[model samples]
Target chain A: MSGAAEQAPVLQVRDLQAHFRTHYFGVNREVRAVDGVSFDVNRNEIYGLAGESSSGKTTLIKTIAGLLKPPLEMVGGSARFSFLPDWDAVGRAPPEVVRAIRWRHLSYIMQGSMNVLNPLRRIKHSFRDFAWRHLGGSKAEFDLRAAAHLERVKLDPSVLAAYPHELSGGMRQRVTIALATICKPEFIIADEPTTALDVVVQKDVLGMIRTIQQEMGSSVLFITHDMGVHAALTDRLGIMYAGRLVEDGETPEIFARPLHPYTRHLIGSLPRIGDTEQREGLEGTPPNLATPPPGCRFHPRCPLAMSVCTTTVPAMIETLSGHRVACHAVNPGMAA
Target chain B: MSALLDLDRVSKSFSRGGLFSTRRVAAVKEVSFALEADKPEIFTVIGESGSGKSTLARMILGIHTPSSGQVRLGGRDVTTYDRRAFMAEVQPIFQNPFEAFNPLKQLDRYLFMTAERFGGASGKTAAEEQADVALRQVGLSLAEIRGRFPHELSGGQLQRVAIARALVAKPRLIIADEPVSMVDASLRMSIVNLFGRLRDELGLSIVYITHDLATAYYISDRLIIMQKGVVVEQGPARAVLSAPTHPYSRQLRDAVLTPDSAGAFRAIHSRQAVATPGVSS
Candidate 1:
């Protein structure tokens, strides 16, 4: 927690592989949900992951959160967190160790607020159920802390008594953010937190998340398919396609000059106000993970795909300092 | 040279309570607009949940009769048309393609059924011919989707099939409710572009209802911004969005998350969160 060690990335994931192995009837198949992905979430920085659905972003999040179950198994590599030097990944960490770190060191804010809160229970009980065990104190002290935290997040303390159904979607989401940050965790993984909300609500919630992360000095791994959200919130950005990290760079750099063809397509496709240029949708669908295309998975739809990309897998290479891309077209001089 | 679709101060209210004290809730409040029969255009309705956009679409599709005023189609009250004849003139494309089609049924069956019922096809071959034509318009061929179930196709492919099904009826107007919201980024523009193409090539007026204002600006010829069942602003899509006069419309436009907006939003974080609205139906 001090000196040069503080400079290291909070989370270092290397060559990670997670696959969904299912045996339906007689056929046994493996969907390479997250194949050979690697990234670093630095301390006190918001790292954004952008990709289309079925592109393995969600699977990657689940694997990182240690929420994997039967059929979805981690096949290879490690996700090392700075907090736990003894274990390489949360998935490999034992139940006792994981329970200790679940909310104290790492927390998650999901899309559906109702899913986090028990519908039948009051907001206070839901907060108590999750945080009281982690933040053990006298019941009175804990209640005071919870109310203070809710007020800090701009909710009326009276809302603590209200049921989840009574609060609006935006308010419920704000409560979810407050609950996630109450422990003052070092890292927060927000999975499409604002996707369910409208434009007005989304902007305000994102502002709160930004403000809280800044005030708490905690790193956040923000994942969403929306480019605008990534542009508005993240410091660093990574683009995933077919379970692989295709591009990673500073958010502004990635937006200014997107290196990978898929990244280019994703950035180019976004329609904005005042701009009247026609944006053509990328052709073909995302690859089916169970039977992804050989070599580069995005080749079928990629306009800049080369002969080398069809046969050989491109290694991630730095075209510019602090910016990395894994595409044969971008780094052609490199040996295949 | 009559109006293709005319809504004259239409209003719809639903009873919300049990037997003791039932109170009427106005879902749509006196909304009015019209599309010309000869001039096909993509008319967009922009609103969030509970904004009455969907309710208005249903009334246009003849699902609900307006509580007051008139919804005239081909210069006649919408309720006056026979149900089957009404469907032949207006088809609907729902948000989720997975839910729109039966999981057990083949995708082509939906298209063929629409063709047989609305396209005046008599036999299987006749239906197939009409279905294939509609599918081809959507850049999909019958051979590729003939025996494929809804689960077998991707969300994008399934949505295209839904659009194809709508096209199969050769309807004069199509009502798409949040059609591209469930679709991925790669295919979203294609589906949105498909709407514009449907207007130009098929001469079909599309009542595209959605919350995504960016896409509404991109494809729509005319648009109305609805807030809480009221049309706060209505005009050409570009002019209204580029320079909205209404305060609510301006707020909605300002809320759009772009790179610049995100950069400029650092100040809003300092503001109190309680000032934000709590309830949106």
Candidate 2:
């Protein structure tokens, strides 16, 4: 993390537009899932991406990770990794090139930990399958290294012998974290890793992630809809709405003074143990990506929406130091 | 003279495998709680996965009979009550609204059926009237949902429709098992707020089963924290949540991440968890 490119971000995503293009009969529909999303994961920092379902958070990550299939196409722009300077996006890169960096330089801690592991195979096989090739080690050496990795996260070494189903949900999550961090990738994509686990286990898993991330000094693009987890785990937080980044800044600052209306609502509406105050849920559903509203996608539901908001898309402006918000009402004069 | 719902040390054990090697798994073990007929309040059952929270909800709903003890609803055993009569008194709001309502079937059918069967609506017009009333209770109109499939409505709207279906029955108690789990974070409050309204306005006692502690504190009047089919803590929601005595309860409380808990990454990175014996082990 601290070398010649120490100042440079590990991952730079710029004006990335990935759409779900579907064609049936005479109709051609393009659902802009990641429309002009731009962000940077700086070296050794946790950048949290927050958004509701269909806000394009998943699409944005998958695009960045180059996990694209049919109907899901990287329409335009680039998500350039520092290691792969020649290539724009992993999606656009050749398979051999893409395959070379996976698990060694880049990895993912997926949401469903159990699904990530083979149901029929022992847990050790997952290690062998995902990390074995990257490490190029003997079976016994890989097993030993995997066991040590598991132990680093405070899991018993015995867990390696058990099947995915045999281990508890929390343990599997820990294993996933260990697996993702084993190679010490410069940047890790953690997609809602703690959302399914119970509060107690969730905290433990989060702590394990923090410890490992700090130890490895790797950048993480942690994505979750839970604001609480964002507040706890991330260094910087970005709020997404309808395939666009609405606001992003330091986690504490965002929590202290949320600039975007949606961010404000998200932070405010969270039910805490001590607070019994009435919190209102936003009206209107998340817009259909296939046919989003004109101008600002959030205008239809934004409580502070004006005529300008309905007509013009808001640019991401630095309202406060390092705090950028995309809202017409927030940045009235700064239309440029 | 009668409690709205009572579970006198009720336990449920599901047998596994065949006769060769039978194993009995106690999903709910010796759990006891009661909601009074005279009072209407949200009584929450909080637990994580495999904690038997769902199993307990089933027993209360009369879907699963307890292996031991009694589940008396309004001074009578839930198993003794006829299915139709029982459903009229207690309605369930499942976790996922998409799965709760048949996607192929129109949303109005559920509301209409509930109206005719449990709501005591005689004619087509009467059923329509009942459905409309229930829909209004959840802040939606029958006209908007009329002839619309489950897919047509959003997750929040479909969940509201499910609630409306529950309301159509005019049930004395509503057993909502993780009702807002599938709904979006932004829309979760609307469904949760609707529960508060149901308690205050409609005077319906709700047994809200969820693992989320924050929401439990927000809506529940009383709550019992469960761990592996055992109640670890039980008291008024505010008192218990604010200062949980049990180790498991304390751990659950401490684990909750909130906006206020945001701290400097370097300074307040990760705290060494205070070890709780017999639990974390």
Candidate 3:
């Protein structure tokens, strides 16, 4: 992770930590969901975050999105979005600035687009409500721009008249994409955008995302646990474990040669189309984030564990190419 | 080879709209397949949202009554079984783990309930032991999960607990409805692999329902592809997936995003279905 200081990372997360501290009938405990993780999602680049359930991938994304609520608290570190550097600054920018930047500078496309759409309103109304104000155009012009964006994503312009319920699952997702991209935001946070769609629909949605990102040159913080999806769509990938990014690198290199034992197990377990090799699943469960295992959190289940692995946490090591991994067995020279 | 579970021309319809303008929405139309008890293979039912895969699964579990045809379990009509008998012979693993179990209640309660209700356990000790055994089968322990609520555990752990609860009944068949879709990517394989293990080791026949062709290709032995209530393709999992004869099946196979073929996936979906477009919702 060299030369991290010189460049102004679009999303600079330094020692970013999030914890789920809870009191269970007077038993106070803290699950370190995102602990001491550091990474930079560079401008106009797709940085992929991969982790299984309980690996703290979702918690990390939620923190980045400034949605820390309830037991989930940002205990330590900083998640500084280039646009929103401070917590208080969010939603407090000058009306004109916020209006101009919100849908135009930063946008998010969620897994289930239905969440963003109002079922009662026609699909076009949802777009008008969010982007119309920022678009700074006449009603006719705004409608025209929205429709053009829809066409770019291969959605029929007629979809604007139909309610969210009237459209198919795939169509609703494409509408959400159009809504997010209509403003041509420089940064887009996509959380498993195609995870819910069918195989065929997933392909179409992912392809649209790839095409639009390439054409627009917008930075995307793509979060999903599916390595296959990550490998297919992301240019760079980061592996999250117990809330920390244990590995980060080019997607192709990570898929071809994973260094972390956990990453190895994760990639090895993926079932290919024609391959029949019996793959062994990782044993034991992910540590309870509220009270995760000591030292290397993955030591209990990692195939290659040492005595040091149980006591001293491993630092993220740059082994080969641009690949960085965190594991005592894999990178033994790291000073913990 | 005798069929363990069979669906013959099964159809499910829901009446919507006003009294005069009642519209018949066919969720599952003429879907048919057979799972052999002797084979004990992972049979996959793949479909998108409106494809009626879930509806077919609910019918198999006797949760929903089919409008026409029959759903047979172990060569007996599924609808014929009363509530108690139906639950004991078949079990279901729902998609969302958080929604599958009550968030307020302890996770062990479901396990104990399953043991007492279906496993014929006599006392708390026996039921606890049975729960522990089932948990162990899924690579979990009762001690760690005994008192945890749905929120306390991760989605993968909760899903594993859901699968364990289904297994306590010792049912001949299990119907997993998008079991791993809600789970994290890394944790997905463990759950899918458990299905294969259960079939091979315990002789449990599983009807794995999912939209993910990668995991389906990885775990399933045979599969039935569904599109808007119709079985578009049905055959051995490998044969059907590798060399799909049907256009819809081929589209599905090509739409799957692998590491090497991510860039070309959209072209596969561009060729829209030439068949009549049904109501997608």
Candidate 4:
């Protein structure tokens, strides 16, 4: 893990910012969804990005995947992937670059599997459409490659003949996984892949993700709002809030000793099956990104908020072993 | 203590397919449970897809009539209640926060509608006040969310708004279907904690439905484990979860991922290697 961490990251995001700037009836508003966020996803590692909706986690992943559509635009920062290094150099990369990189070197397992698969088209056609071009071989070779990918994810090859609607939700997701992985991408961005799944099936899907990630040696940017899923699958975790990375550390360390008040509250609020702790809800709703709080965005909801917190944005500081936090209460330098 | 809501051998079946090939899909079969009115508590219904937990929730809410048996709300048959009265007594918070409210409409409109309909708030001002109070209960202010669209607010904020809307009616029961499933991990806890608070402070009974058991055990006082519409087990939350008697319930419990057992999650990955038959089909 340390060796991979030290190496040039497979996906290096530096101060990446994607904002939703809208003009409605002569009024202009900018939502700072992913504001000055930086992270590195190394090869063969599962980097868990945990944040609530509106935390900008989704925007961050979307920006990384080159799937950004306006009114959500890349305001600033660079998302540099090892495979797509030159793609970002020009304002618009060539179609061949995009076509070659997609699924071949970069893949995404989305929240809704239906988003990728055509409802009318059979699963085999979808596979062929996605992987056939990239495989660059005879139809039989592509078919064999697709079957091998499905087999790795523990999906039956028979699903290829069925339509997406004919298959169950879990099966469709597995097919999506198989679709995304058939080309053996170096980086995989999974955004809430199992959020819609049942508890039993969620377990199955997550297990597949872990197994495939390990076996394929692909770096995964696994994003979910469920800390439990993050704890289970991710080796390292980063907590995002108000479009910024608030904390980043080992999964176990963050779970055991969460530094940021927001992270602390988030971890404390989790309902363990056996342990029944009296959990308190965070005091206020997340700030509207169009006009976020004056200083620290989370200050309105942080129980330990001080005068400084309302005035100055706290820097994410490494307070303990690989644990970084962006909060005035936790990091002493920010305290006034 | 008599049950506030009771389902006696209740079942719901839907016929699918063409006229020539008729298929009877048993969404809920022989499901029986009771929610004590006197002892108001959050009673969770746990199941996977096709577990029939949601179908049962809809029946309790009077949104759907049971094909057989009885679903009594406060000793009165649910199907017999008038729409207004049933809605006043039981409100719902749907699974998808984005789809719950009309995209064109402001979020506050739902709150005012509930307030006017259920709270008997005579005028616009009174309804606004009622809506404000309900929002406050869910840790939100009406001023902040008054003109906001569903897309403007985060999933957590939207779900809280949904819950607050449910509270505006001051219903005896709130049927929440996967309320926090879409909300982010950090935001999910806050919503789950709110359910606990509502039960304690407002004395409101909640029919919390989800495939997630960790939150179920955290807030639920008594829970029923359901599988393909069958009640596998029903008892006190702690007792049943800690020592589940039924094999299905045990399987569901074991599938739960806790922070402590992060390393152990891999073991349960292969437990369900065989794909189970679809109950709906």
Candidate 5:
């Protein structure tokens, strides 16, 4: 693990900012969805991005994958991947290069299986559509490779003949995973891939993800709102609040001793089976990113908010070894 | 004491397929449970997708009629109750808060309308007053929600408003089908905690339906574990969760990911690998 840490990161995102510039009847609004976020996915590491809806997690991953469109613009900063060094910022890369890099070098497994797999088309056709151009093989060879990939994810080859609706939700998700991993991409972006699955099926699907990642020796940027899932799957976890990463560290460290107030509240709030003790919910809702609270984005809901928290954005500082937190109250300029 | 809500061997079946090739699918099969009238408690139905938990919730709420047996509320057949009276005594909180209300309409309209139609509020002033009271129960004010569209409020706030709308009718029983599932994690506890408060303070019975075992364990007083339209286990929530007797129930419990159980994925992987062989690591 120590040796792996010394190796260069597979994906490095530095001071990234992506904003949604919307115009409703000439009324201008700018929602800073991803504001100065930075992180790195180490080689062969499963880095979890934990946040709720509107926390800019999805937007950040989209920016990283170079999936930006009209209103959602990459305003500043960089998303640098190890494989695509020719492009300084992948989000700003040329369309042809993005198309060339996608599937072969980078792939994504979305939350909803229906989003990836067409409802009308058979599962095999969907696989062919995504992986065919990258695989560069005859139809027969593609079929053989697809079957082998499905087998790896524990799905039978017979599923290729059936429509997406015919299979169970869990089975469809496994097929989606198989489609994403057919190329053995260097960096895989899985956005809440298992959130829609049941507990029993979720365990199996997670196992499949772990197995595939290990076999491919790929880095994964796993995004989900569920802390338990993060705890189970991720090597390192980053907590996103509003549009900023409030805390990030090794999963066990974040779970054991969370430094940021928001991180502490988030980890403390999860309800466990044997523990019947009442857990306190955070006081306020997540700030509206359009006009987010001035200083620290979480100060309004932070229990330890001081006057300084309202006016200045807290800088990400290291509290413990490998644990980085952005909080004025906790990281009072004292290095651990 | 008499039962507040009772399901007596109730079952629901749906017919699907094209003409001349219809197939009958049993969605819920012979599910029986009861909540006592005097003792309001959270009765949770835990199941995965296609486990008939949602079907059972729909049957209890009278959205779908049972093909066999009966669902009785306060010793009265659910099907027999008039729409107004039925809605007054029973309300529903759906899974998706975004879908619960119309995006084009104001959020508080549902609350005021429920108060006027089912809460016995005669005039606009009375309806607004009732709406305000219901919203207060969920820790919101009409002032905050009034005239605001559904898109304006956060998911947690929208769900709370949905609960408030349910409260406006002053329902004896509320059938919540995965109410907190869509809400953010930090706010999920508040909504779950609200259920306990509703049971204690408002004396309202809730039929909480979810696939999540953790929240079910946290809030439910009594629960039934369902699998493929059959009730696999039923008992006090704590007892059933702590030491599940059924094989499926134990599997579900063990699959639940908790913070304390770090590295649980590897354990689950190996165990399932033993059950179904030949999948490469």
Candidate 6:
């Protein structure tokens, strides 16, 4: 892990800000979906971003992957990949450049496997549509490469002849992963890949992800709300709250001693088997990002919020060697 | 005392493909279970997507009749009971909160309607009063949900409202199919906890269906594990989960990813690596 960190980061995202601009009739509104997020995915390491729905994790990944359209705009920030260093501005990259880099240098495995694999076509055709152009080979050669890739993911090559609907959910997801990594990209963005899967199949899929990432030495940006998945898979984890990163550290360190109050509540609320001693849910709902509270976005829900917390926004600062947190109560007397 | 709900060798089958090339597929095989009338408990049915858990739930709700066997409520077969009489004794909470209600309508309409239709409330004032009582049982009030639309409320609030709607009829049993799965993690426990409270205080029997083992262990008194429409294991929830005897149940338990089970990933990964020699170390 230390050696992996010593190498240059595969993906560096600095102060990224993505907001949703909605106009209904004449009224204009702005939802700050991803507000000043910064993180780094070290080479060959899995960085997990943990956030509940509408915490802007999906928006952040979409912004990074340059999938943002109108209404959803990347106002500021730079997402630079080691392979595409010349194009520091990922969100604003040219279509040709983005297309050229995709599948060869960067690939994505989204939540719904159906979204990636076409239901009307056979699995092999979907593979051909995605990775065939990226791989410089004839049709027969590409077919061989595709079969070999499916074998790597522990899927039968016979699945290529069947439609997406024919394969089971878990099998289709594995095929999606195989398609994404067919060219052996340098970086992969997996957004809740195994979330739709059952627990039994989820473990196998995650094991495949870890094994494939380690074999290819590709940096993976894994996003899911499940802390259990993060504990088992990720090397480092960043906790997101109200569109802002509240904490970031090694997986075990953050789980053992979470610095931020929100992180503490998030990890503490998880229900485990053999432990049923009246676990309480966090009171109040996540703050609405469109009209978030003043100062800190989470101050209204924070149990230890103080007077200063209402007027001053906390900055993410390093308290331990590599751990960082954004809470005034945790890092008292720290200049805002 | 007679059993409240009795499932005797119930089975459901569905046909696929075109008219000429039709194939029969059994969604749920001969499954049997019963709930006693005097005692209330949480009975859980655990299974994966295609494991026929949903099919069993539909049969219990009378939405789909079993191809074989019978589903009896209070010693009377469910198929013979009238719609109003059956709904008055049994209710359901669906998986997705957003889809359970109409987005354009106020959230309170369903509660008020249920009260009027099933609670013997004729007047608007009487319906409103009954709705308020039911909402109070779920820790909500008529004021908070008076004119609010379904989109205005969060998933947890909407689910609680759904539960309140079910309670308006004073049903003996509630069939919740993955109710909390769509809710946020931080708010999930509150709903699960509410079920526990309902069983204790309100004397409501619930059939909890889910793929999540942890929550199933927390609240269920008895549970059955299903695999591809067949029940592989059934017993006391805590005892069975703590020490599963079936090979499939043990495999499912071992596959569960807990915070403490980080080593399970490495073990599975190495085993997979050996199975597929194509993966370069």
- What does candidate 3's lDDT look like per residue over A1-336, in tens digits? 233224466677878878887898998888788899888786556788888766787788777665677788887777766766544332334456555556677788988778789999998799989888777779888888888889998988899999998888889999888888887776788887877777777877887887787566567898887777887778689988877788998787888888898888888777778877776656766777756778898889887888888888899878897788888888885745
Judged by TM-score relative to the true structure, which candidate is superior, 4 or 6?
6
- lDDT score at residue A154, model 1, on the 0-100 scale: 90
lDDT of 6 by residue, B1-281 (tens): 79999999999999988999999999999999999988999999998889999999999999999999999999998999999989989999999999999999998889888887777788899889988988999889999999999988878889999999999988999999999989987788889999999999999999999999988988899999999999999999989999999999998888887777754544433323223223121
TM-score of only chain B in every candidate structure: 0.93, 0.93, 0.92, 0.92, 0.93, 0.94
lDDT string, candidate 2, A158-188, tens digits = 9898999988889999889988988878789
lDDT of 4 by residue, B34-93 (tens): 888988899988889888888998888887889999999889998898889888889999
Better model by DockQ, 1 or 4?
1
Per-prediction DockQ comes to 0.36, 0.42, 0.29, 0.33, 0.44, 0.43
Output the number of the DockQ-best candidate.
Answer: 5
Model 5 ranges off by over 4 Å: A333-336, B266-281
Please give the distance, in angstroms, between residue B245's alpha carbon in candidate 3 and its true position after superposition.
Answer: 0.9
Model 2: how far residue A183 lies from native, Å: 1.6
Q: Candidate 2 at A73: error in angstroms? A: 1.0
TM-score of chain B of 5: 0.93
Which parts of model 3 are misplaced by more than 4 Å? A1-9, A19-31, A67-100, B121-133, B140-148, B262-281
Candidate 6 segments exceeding 4 Å error:
B266-281
Supply the global lDDT for candidate 6.
0.88
Instruction: Give the TM-score of each candidate.
Output: 0.95, 0.96, 0.88, 0.90, 0.96, 0.96
Query: For candidate 3, lDDT tens digit of each residue in B122-162?
Result: 89999999999999999899999878889877788899999
Ranking by lDDT: 5, 1, 2, 6, 4, 3
- Quote model 6's TM-score: 0.96
Model 6: per-residue Cα lDDT over A1-336, one tens digit each: 556555667789999999999999999999999999988887767899999888999999999988989899999888888777787766678899899988888899989998878889998899889988878689888888899889999998898899998988999999989988998888899999999999989988999998888677677899999888998998889999989998998888998898888888878877777887777777778778888888888888888999888988888899997899988897876644
Screening candidate 4 with a backbone cut-off below 3 angstroms (N, C-alpha, C), the clashing residue pairs are A225-B185
